[model samples]
Target: MSDNLQEDQQQAVLCDMCTEEDRKPARKTCMKCEISMCVHHLQAHVTTPVLLQTHPLTEPMASGAAGTTKCPQHGKLLEYYCLDDLTCVCVSCAIEDQHRLHNMKTFSTAHKELMEKLNAEQQALAKDENVSLEKWENGEREKLGSSSVRLIEAVSKLRDIALTSVQTSVSARMVSIKTSKSSMQVAQNEKDTFRFLQMFSQVHQDFEKAKAVDLRKGLEPGSDRDKLVQELRQGGEEMVAQAVQLWGSLLILVDPENHQEVFTTSSDLTFDPQSLGIGMSLSKDHRKVFYNSWLGQLSAHTLRIRSVHSTSNFQRWMVSLSEDCDWTIGLCDKESAENLKDGHVYGLRCQGNQLSSLTTDYYDFTDASRNLEDSSFGLQKVEIPKTEKKRRVSSQLIKCPGESGGDITPRPQKVEVFRNIAASSLSFFSRTGQHQRTEILTMKMSFDSSDFFAFVNLEKEQAQKSSNQPPGPQQQWMCSCGKVYIETGSGYSYGGCYYSKSPQAICSCGRVIGGRVIGDPCITEVVCELL
Candidate 1:
């Protein structure tokens, strides 16, 4: 604004062709010519036949360093860069045999374009890094906040207990001292020096008794400290659990809120209301299949079909279950539900951790010599191999995860079954309390749907919950080794106990429960995982 024009004019370069007496400021600089020219000389240079059709021109820099950088390839000032070869090329070298076919661009133009690209990528990287750092910091902050709250509560509780202990001790001591004082006063009032002198030892004994009360007993609870230690060490302890463990290792991420609120997520679960079995109702935005008291009920064995076949419309679907939840949970097609009274249908049934279903190969039911199991309606069981004791299986079926294909083991906890209907496969997996997915079973695609691919089976009604239900009058604890550990003549039966005389307990559900037999009431409770 203050006339830098005069300064520019004063520093203007003289035309190389102009005379000193009538010098003219340069208007253009030819990069090939490596010189400047005034307007008149520039026009003459452009018109001259000796010059090429066009000459490259650029503005002068304040430092006068423009057009001074040399190219390593041809040893001339670098005017262009060959992007194809990733090399610098001078004006003279650009037409040479080595770079004639190369894709060359002016250095300034190429540099400008590349700089913009680099800046954009750098900005994106910075944004990503900031987001990750913020998340990590937030997690640390939450942990610190929770820990501070717990510590403050624990300390305050201990402080109150210590204060109360000392206060009680002091009060008791004061009462003893008062009694001694009264006795001393009596002695003095009677004017007896001998009795008062002897009273000192008695008073000393009373003081010792006051000191005997423990200052650290209940006030310093060792259990509280032990709890903190145990929490810190919990991750390192060896844990025994039942689930579909991976072949080697896996990383599981969980959001407890996400799991608890699964019923509300409509996008993940697909339910067809029309295909529901009688007495079953949809809940939690149609993500859950639950019993409906208002609806007329059907037999528990009735199969619930999905309106849409997974093989055609949906490629995959998964059903999640909780521990102690009752559901057959499987993959079946249109034919699976039809003609089942004919003693067969194609489907995969997961009961507890075990995967059991009639396959292409089935039992020969005609064997009279061998013991045979009674077939249930719409279900055929290969006669269970006879153990030493032929214990009767419960009418209610419990399935477990991670059990062998033929095992009758019960899975009594949270698990999910994934069906890839088209691929003709079903996967059984389980989730621990920690919400980690362990794969339970992956069978070869056998339930190829002739029609239906997406199907589910559920009980008509949930068994009513009985509070504090004691062991039946005839409960007995049976071992996996087929011997009764605690025999009861009452003839009532519970799930077998978990532990045996052997080193390891082998069963599908991981543990067995026998209430009165092992003298453990805890056995009556279906345990999921140790929290």
Candidate 2:
């Protein structure tokens, strides 16, 4: 009897619907109703569709524990989530209380939505992390490679200097030793006693001088060669330390979230006069570049701008090109510019009717046409054939490069270039019109050094007038009388409104239209009409 009473007392949860006289153990708890039920009462929750859907069932819970799931004021299960208040509320709280008219969703639906948003955020974060990691790895590799190259070059130069010094010292010592031995041999061959004695002192002095010569003097401490070695060692250590510090700084700057902040728009860029090739001339302000044929040479002339070094940070700039001219614009480091052939340069080139991303192993510095046969990278060559549609006269008037006459694709007037050092990307854009631009191409290449410069190669067929030049006499004109005239020169002749090189010119309507002094070579008065 005591064991039975103990067992009954050990059961912590009891059915709420059961009477105290015949209490039954709980099977499941309804969170919505905040009540524990035995199997007999729980059957309603399983069989009833509304209860199964609306009421969330859980393992048997104690009586007072369910109070937390209900709203404090309404004493109802908090089954709905209020989006506006970012809180959980019961149906009564959502519809009849302060949450009335607020955006709301079922608790399960809100949880699902939150989960989906979290998943998307996780995916975006992962992608950003991957990109940042790739950039960091590439930067490390490039930095290591360039540093190794510099170190190797420095060591090789030092080796050559040391070797040359040692060889020169050895040669001089050998010559002295040979001369001293020859003099001693001559002195030993003398038969006369007096001649032998006379030559003995000089031979002895020569022998002593040859013996005193130090073969390792050039390599000794405080010597020029020794100083060069010490300097190289100290410089190498300093360079390594500086490189490590710079790497740490770069790591801090390479955050994907702040990558855009690394880029800067520089508008005050100017042409580097020293980088201009023959036949290339810059305007007074070093902004505009003009290229004229030199002695009928068909080679291209290259001009470079003193823009930001590509390895330092991201940079962007814009350039305007002359219509109907062969041009190539790109970035090149100091080594590449000096040795254009067999050097890597990233650029976009427009040749004849074809536009392509410039990628060639061997580009002739003096001739852009030589690069046409080279393979292109990233963007495929797009041949822009002449359109048959009748276009504006301005576009048709301009001739293609190397073409005496004929139409071709309209040339892009402006180009915007972006150099992203961190991303190792070079992007090109063609400005189609005001506030509109189309991406030309994006090249992925490493900027190994800080000596990168913006380069442009232009080959113009002939000297052309500026696009801002005034209109000619062939422009249509309209008079105040609403009369339209074509091919009207400085003087007009229409409906007896004759204006010529006279002291005074008048229109048929008795209005003074134009005037010029008689026998004067220049017109004293000029009148312009709008059409």
Q: For model 2, how does the per-residue alpha-carbon lDDT over 100-216 read when each residue is reduced to its tens digit?
A: 899899877898998999999999989979998898788877876776666566667657766887787688778878989999999989999999999899999889988987886
How does model 2 score by TM-score?
Answer: 0.34
> Which regions of candidate 2 deviate over 4 angstroms?
1-28, 35-40, 48-67, 71-76, 82-87, 90-103, 115-143, 146-150, 153-531
User: Model 1, 221-336: lDDT tens per residue?
Assistant: 46754664464344223111211121011222233322321122225345666665544544434555443233444344433434332324224344554333334554444544
lDDT of 1 at 484: 33
* Worst lDDT 10-window in candidate 1: 240-249
Could you tell me the lDDT of residue 483 within candidate 1? 33
RMSD to the hidden true structure, all candidates = 20.1, 26.9
User: How many clashes does each candidate structure show, in the order listed?
Assistant: 19, 0
For each candidate, the alpha-carbon lDDT, in order, equals 0.49, 0.64
Let me know the TM-score candidate 1 reaches against the reference structure: 0.33
